[model samples]
Target: MERSLAALLVCVFGVTTGEFVLAGILPAVAGDLEVSIPAAGLLVTAYALGMIVGGPLLTAITAGRPRKPLVVGLLAVAVAGNLLSAVAPGYGVLFAARVVTALVTSTFFANAIVIATSAAPAGKQASTVAKLVFGMNLAMILGAPLGTWIGEAFGWRATFGAITACCAVGLLLVARLVPGDQPVTRSRAFGEFTVFRNQDLVLAIAITAVANIGLLMVFTYLAPLLTGPGAFAAAAVAPMLLVYGVGATIGNLIGGRLADRALLPSQLGALAVLVVLLVALWASPHPVVTGLLVFAAGAVGFSVIPGMQTRVLTTAAAAPTLAIAVNASAYQVAAAFAGWLGGRVIAGPGMTSIYLAAALATVLGIGLSAVALRRDRVRVKQSVLR
Candidate 1:
């Protein structure tokens, strides 16, 4: 909609690309650095850990400054991080570089939510946040595939180099298009957590975490799932991911619109669909069927994201930015947890177990969403009577 919002979206796209491009190139990185695959996986783990720590910390530290400059500065950090990764001589250097990138990633991700909501028209705030989130999904859909292609064709370093260039473009757009606005000076760090005292907000965040656990559980192991015995050929992975990306793009737009129209019902339906889809993915025997189910899983899982975000915004009206930022951090925490859990399952039982666990988590998320809806209705009735 707004030029400023578009600029922020560009920044989000670049940040997301920089953050996740490593997934597609991990094998190359492992080979190049002479590390095991599990160890190379630490690059993703390290970034998530950084985000878990950095999101709230940076949100609080920058609470007193202007948002535009802070966002621009964070993008600069992302650019530098990617550049460092491109030139890393060893696994340790790459890991450190990922952490640095995540620090900026956390700050930028949280602040973008703040800026989007602030810039939107009164009733469209949640929709604005969803549009920014669309950039994130698109990055996964587009960035990872493209990065993998580049990595395969050139080298993993080239993928990182390309991301560095994208970050540069994002920085230039932020500088040119984003309006100069002072940050919300009244918002404090822990003040946002007060929303947790509201049962609906707490439930909403929990639902978000649960939903993500399901999504990331499968996603974290997608490559291996596709390449393992009875799985799709290596040549099919990129094409299947392209299908998944399309589903993700559609899901993001649908989620935003549904949330804008009817938040609770949309969320409930999405969670239910996600649970069913995950179960179906676990049950599918054929590789093509599994690939299609993966696409369905992406569609349904992402379709809930905007609704969950809007639910938090509505429940925590007092500190929307802090709540949203904290929620972003929560998602990363969920991702890290999901990755760990999925890894454990893969090591113990198999990849199928990850989807089974995800399905169970999605069911739990549905129950949480129901509780949140009931709590919100109770609050509304009380306010009306008052």
Candidate 2:
């Protein structure tokens, strides 16, 4: 990998690690801060809220800036946030620090994606984007776990301190290696909102929001699903989740390859496969079979992401950062909705039905994706006639 891309990948990994590492250390945080676990859990909600609210606004606020400087600056903000988190004197301050960290998270990620994909070799955008996405996959697999370990071994504050150090390394690399030649002199501050008027762009964003809801919901509840319906030992949850992460990593790479060949068709096919796989998880009669199903679900479920993200970037290439930021925000919104919907499903139907509920959500995503593609085709034919 190019050093510049590597730096950006590290930034992606560090920033994402900041987003998720809270899960592993919430108990430590709550106990130290003298707050309840649920209160510390609100730290997660606050970060998500910040991302959903902050990404587009910040992206728009900084439209047309030089990409290199913007991303580096955002990483600097991330460093400050995490440092504040490490030294926060009380829960209120730590909560603020988390929101501050999250506010820059998605926007920084969007800019990095734009930078990386802009520098990609021709016809390799999806594959390149996947490389950046791979950083997030590693965050789930490695960064979060490592940070959790640091928290366990030292203290929760040490986890944030470690994240801060990682972001600082990414910042130094980005400053030294990533090229700053790209500039968006044409991007209007608020005029980028006009991108929203594009039907395909709208659909691309919708596909992201709708399709991933299923997998996110199911994954959110996977531990329970494993120990409950699958009748696995409680100790087995982490290993099974590891199985899913391995599958996700492979799926991300495969999705990148498929998307480079054919973006929408591959996305559609992947979504179909995801729906089938989610539904398929319903029939796991043995532990080994259940593990395999979890892996398949992870693989097929994540295979759609690269295409989805790439479509938004391509559709809004004139000014892709804000669009990408909006797309990120949409995914956050989907995650929140998935949490709510999964809760309802569990309360009403039961834990086993969560899989079916997730499958149904993706089926809705399929419908939206089909509509978006059809609209794009019609627009193309009309313009060709014109």
- TM-score against truth, every candidate: 0.90, 0.97
Write one digit per residue (lDDT tens) for candidate 2, span 1-386.
38988999898999899998999899999999999999999999999999999999999889988888898899999999999999999999999999999999988989988888888898899988888998999998889889999999999999999999999999999999998797565666787888899877888998999999999999899999999999999999878888898899899989998999988888888889888888888876788888998999898888888888999998997669999999999999999999999999999989999999998999999999888778878888999999
Residue 187, candidate 2: Cα error in Å is 3.4
Q: After superposition, how far is residue 85 of candidate 1 from its true place, in Å?
A: 1.7
Q: What residue runs in model 2 are displaced by over 4 Å at the alpha carbon?
A: 379-386
Question: How much lDDT does each candidate structure score?
Answer: 0.80, 0.90
Candidate 1: give the clashing pairs: none
The candidate maximizing lDDT is 2
> How far is each candidate from the true structure, as Cα RMSD in Å?
2.5, 1.3
Q: What TM-score should be assigned to candidate 2?
A: 0.97
> Once model 1 is optimally superposed onto the true structure by TM-score, how far is the C-alpha of residue 372 displaced, in angstroms?
0.5
